[model samples]
Target: MVEVEAAGLIAIGAGIAVGLTGLGAGIGEQSIGAAAIGAMAEDPKFFGKGLLMTVIPESIVIFGLVVALILLFVF
Candidate 1:
């Protein structure tokens, strides 16, 4: 019984880890994407840099997923 409860808690923790990070990344990406678009508008040459900047926030979500997996599988 105790082990079952522990497992449940771990699942919850993992879900929170992934969920919050994804939300945060989404919010971050929104702003970055807008700025990237604006920058691109001013100078067409900014496209590469703008795209790179816009994609950077997505890595946060990947990190979150890794954490969640670790939580679920480890300890």
Candidate 2:
């Protein structure tokens, strides 16, 4: 019973962490993506930098996913 409760707590916490971080990352990436596309439309040469900047938010979600997975399995 205690183990189950602890696991539940860990799951909840991990979920919350992932949810918040992912939400922020999604929002951030969307903004960057929009800007990147707009910039690219103006000048094709800006593609590299714009794309790089847009994908920068991926790290946040990746890190959050790592933490969430670790919590789910390790706990």
C-alpha RMSD by candidate, in order: 1.2, 1.3
Per-residue lDDT of candidate 2, residues 1-75 (tens digit)? 999999999999889878988898999999899999999999999999998999899888888888999999886
Q: Write the per-residue lDDT of candidate 1 for residues 29-75, one digit (tens) a residue.
A: 99999999999999999999999999898898899899999998887
Poorly placed runs, candidate 2 (over 4 Å): none
For candidate 2, the per-residue lDDT at 65 reads: 83
Q: Which residue ranges in model 1 land beyond 4 Å of their true spot?
A: none
Candidate with top TM-score is 1
The local lDDT score (0 to 100) that residue 54 gets in candidate 1 is: 91
Task: Assess every candidate by TM-score.
Answer: 0.88, 0.85
Each model's total of backbone clashes? 0, 0
